[model samples]
Target chain A: MIDTIAKLNGIIQILALVLILIRAFLVVRDLTKSVTGVFFMFAIFTHLSADMYYLIHIAMNKGYYPPFSAMDLAALGTYLLFGAAAHSLFPERTGERSETIVSVCAALFAAANVFLWGYYSGAWFQDIFSGITFIYLLVTSSQAVYRTGALKRDKWYILGSIWLTFVAGQVCVPILQNAGAVLAANAVEWLNYSLMFGTFLWLAAKVILCARRTEKDQALALSFGLMCWSLCTLYMCAEPFYQLALFGETFQLLLMWFIIERRVKTA
Target chain B: MIYSENIFICIVIPLLLSLLFIRREGFRFVLGLVIGMLVCLLSAYISAFTGTVSEMGHEQVAVYISPVVEEIMKILPVLFVLFIFDPPSDRVFLFAVAVGVGFATFENCCYLLSVGSQSITYMLIRGLAVGVMHIVSILFATIGLMQMREFKAMSLPAAFGAVIVSITYHALYNLLVSEPGITSVIGYLLPGVTAVLLFLVNLRLRIRVKT
Candidate 1:
């Protein structure tokens, strides 16, 4: 079962990567059209880097940097880079000050990782580090949704739904697990995957809609990518939850296609 | 210090020969290659020089320092070209590739010198791995170059973006192969395989764009 889930996740990750690389290839000649392209590039590549780091960890019994594997740290890097990308996409909308604040916060997080690399020895610290990063992402992404005016628009309803569903699942699963309702907890977990899948689909719809409405749709695509990643990180921490990761990565690929298709059409 | 003499001889001969070979059809690529190799050598010397000054050991240099040094070295001339020629961005990518190819060729020659021609199979695989890596690093930077285009001019953020992507990719490759056996197997094939896959994707995307 673990192998099957991992294989599915692998295929999804590859799809995500291939889609972005295709977009990269398309724009390899002219990434100037979208400032967000670099963020997408960093996000995808770091993701692949993290994935490879995990593969090495398990295969070679290395990278167990006490409490957290190097892959965990790499995952943190991806999250921050995505956060920056999301904020950078809507400078006019998100405000320069907020972006600068996020940058400083992210820099602190990166410093914490470097410190952990040398001195970390406890899981709780790692978890708290990740949790703090997750919360920061949630806040920034919320601001992104508002800054992009997605909160007010009917078109952004799906994003709100996706975020709400993910948050509710996160809140409920632990409660159910604590109640010793193993069966109920399992069910909510599955629901998390299903709802996220739907939410990403919704996000995909919004990306295309925004592409039509905005001149800098790639920024929107990147912002969408950040939200998907944030949701995935929130839910996909354990192996059984690996299935949810497929959803976030799949959403990224879908958006990648939307950006490329939009670009080709406009060109 | 061990490599300076041979690397210099290697650079100077090619540099002089390329100067004479200017009328050749592939001279521009060779020029890119030799210049790239020279930069690669210069980068190595700089890193060596830096190593002497910094407290980090040689292992740290290989895994951490070399990528930053080599990537900056590899992209310097390309950046110059980008600024001076201001060719279409696509041409910039192509130019970067030319430099990558050149750098890889010289670096391979140096490797052969240090490690011996060895078994052709080993040399061939190493060549393929290093060549692909060199190309991909520049491509990674070029991809970074594309991202900053929104500003409508080359800027620090743009250059920094390019370096970050390039450095991370370079560092990732170094880390992956930092292990041996199974990790090495994937590491060896990864660059070459991915480079081909990227080419195919680009080709297919181009066709789709046309139709």
Candidate 2:
């Protein structure tokens, strides 16, 4: 069952990669492009690059994942690119003291996870790298939200909260499972699925509303990518329905691509 | 057992001396080559140590760990130069390719020394595949770095993301080529295909920029 899911997940990524390559080709062809659009495309590329490693691991290990590998760095690259996109779109500088505090806190939290879970040294290295990048994403993304004004803040909040809940479910599922609370773990997993479904429906509504708007906000479009990325990372951490997670991610990418295509056509 | 350092020393001395006659970009390329060879040697030691500590087989280590080490070592100089000298994007790209070439050349030498250069076809494939793979991977990272810098979004996540693209590409190649036969053929062709695509994309972009 797991192997089948892994293979299916790999297929989804390949399909998504093809879609991304087409989108990238289009974006690259368009001479009049924003920095945010470029970064957004690159973010997808980096994320897909990391997925290649994931696919290779599936083939090599027959669905069993190694405790740690350098490929995780590419996933980190995905977040970094998204952060770059957020920064480019918003271009607001946050307070260094606050950024530092978040960094410290993230580092401490990562360290706690490392010790609490007894992660290997290699995993610890990646965990720290992710921690630092995650904080950067949070800081830049919040800055982006702040810069987007009042009207679109609700969209950011909704998507952001859904991502947070999914990630929280990811965290709890493992802890619950480890503690022999199988029912609780199962419950958390179901909640994650429900949240994913809810987000999908919510995004569908938003896409419709966004399409109807006269001035399509770039910030909201970028936020969708960010939400998809956060979802990707959460699934990558403790993947229960790994294939489903990837399907959701690719679906989000498709929607974003559709938006870009529509905008270009209208332009 | 291969004495990589001996080969490195023998090749590097002449190159180091040639640097006196060379200037500017030529100097940077030669210097990058020399640094790349040194980095390759260091990477070998590190990989060996890691293999020993992890109790992994040679093939396992090569496929799983060495790509990460090699890619990181290859990019360190580029990163250093970027942050310190703050050179133009073209210079950085040239320097990066040079480092990759240097690293590939040294690796090929060691490989040839270990296994006799009997099979011309195999050697050709190895040279084209491995050499271009190294250059392509590093160039990918360099381009990412340049993009981030150009956009004034040069943060840790951005830089690392750029670096990790190379690492993942290297790792994927390593993973693919580790097994022989069909997979190996695909692996060998992957870099060349990617390079051609990148070249075409770059040409298109340059034309757009000019127009």
Candidate 3:
């Protein structure tokens, strides 16, 4: 069963990687149109390289490697790049207090991870860096939704809640597994999948609706990108969750395409 | 078995002397080169200590730890310049490239000493591949930070994000090249491909900004 799932994961990763490459080319071809496009391209490029690394590892049949590797670092890079994309896309209209609140939350998240996971090595380093970027992304996307005035904003808040719950579930799975709570870990793993699937559905609906609207809303597209980013971070931590992460990546690439397509249309 | 310090001293003296004649951005460039070499040495010490403490094998250390240590060390000077000197934003790229060049040059020297420079083709490949990899990785951070600075959205996350991008790229290269066969070939070519892509993007972005 596990072998079948692993093979499925590899197949889907290759599929997603191809999609990402095509999207990257499209973004780069039209990149001169907007500064935000450049950052988005970088974000996509990181995902491409990271996914390529994993695929190559599997192809090489190199088994039982270190727990932390290029994929972890690349995951961190992907989040950071998305955070950059958000920063470049949205204007910095939020006050310093909001920034501070986000920073505090990020710190608390890091502290919690350390308390749970232990400050060991590369994983810990990635966790702290991921923590900061994660919080920044959450705040920036929420802020984009809040300020865009196009979406209902309440739906975004709800989406945010679901995504956070999924992340919390992901963060707990390893702890439970490590503590020999195998059944509990499996249960949470299922719960995480449901939450992520629902989140993707909600986001897809949001993207389609926004596209149907009369006005072109950049923030809505960017928020969708950022939300998908939140979903994509955990594949490094959980092996079973790889398929769902690829689903999230598909959503992200489609979002990038939407943005580029919109830009080209407007141009 | 290679005496890295001797190589450093032999190269640094002339570079330092040349610095006396250079001025303005040229001065900063030479200074950046010198600092890059210095940081390369420091990174060796730090990675050595980290490897011992972590108890990982040499290959593991090279793939997992060295990139993080070396990238951070390489970027330290650029970060210092941004924070303290606050040189013109455009000049940051020069400092970044200089640091990467210096670090790569020193690293190549060490490589030659460790394994005699028997094959010119291999040396040329290393020079182009590893050298461009270093430059392109640091440029990722430099360009990201510059964009954030331009947008007035430069935050701690953005800065760290830029550095993390560099670290991850370096790690990916190290991981790929650490093995033999097709993976190593991909690793060697990755840098040049990325450099070309980034150059075009940077050029277009600059033109967009100016116009």
Of the true interface contacts, each candidate retains a share of 0.16, 0.61, 0.31
| Candidate 2 lDDT, B152-201, residue by residue in tens | 77777667777777887888888888887677788899999989988987
How far out, in Å, is residue B28 in model 1?
4.7
Tell me the tens digit of each residue's lDDT in model 3 across A1-267.
Answer: 756766676567557656755555544545535556656666666666677667666776766555546676666667666766665555656564644544454345434544333332346655665565565665555455444554454654564465467558867787899999999998997887777666666666666666666345543444544453445444333555665575566665666556555765565
Question: How much DockQ does model 3 earn?
Answer: 0.31
Q: Clashing residue pairs, candidate 2? A: A77-B161
- Identify the CAPRI category of the predicted complex in candidate 2: medium
In the predicted model 3, the residue pairs found to clash are none
Q: Which ten-residue region of model 3 chain B has the weakest summed lDDT?
A: B149-158
Using TM-score, give the best candidate's number.
Answer: 2
Give a tens-digit lDDT track for model 1, residues A137-222.
54445456556555344534554445456656756786898899999999997887677556555555656666666544443644
Residue runs of model 3 more than 4 Å from their true location after superposition: A1-35, A61-68, A91-129, A150-195, A218-245, A264-267, B206-211
Alpha-carbon local distance difference test for all models: 0.62, 0.72, 0.70
- Candidate 1 residue pairs in clash (backbone atoms < 3 Å): A31-B146, A32-B149, B33-B102
The TM-score each candidate achieves on chain A is 0.66, 0.69, 0.70
Model 1 DockQ reads 0.16
Model 1 ranges off by over 4 Å: A1-42, A64-144, A152-267, B20-31, B46-60, B147-159, B176-180, B205-211
Candidate 2 stretches greater than 4 Å from native: A29-33, A62-67, A93-129, A150-192, A212-215, A218-222, A225-240, A260-267
Label model 1 with its docking quality class.
incorrect
- Residue A264 CA error for candidate 2 (Å)? 6.7
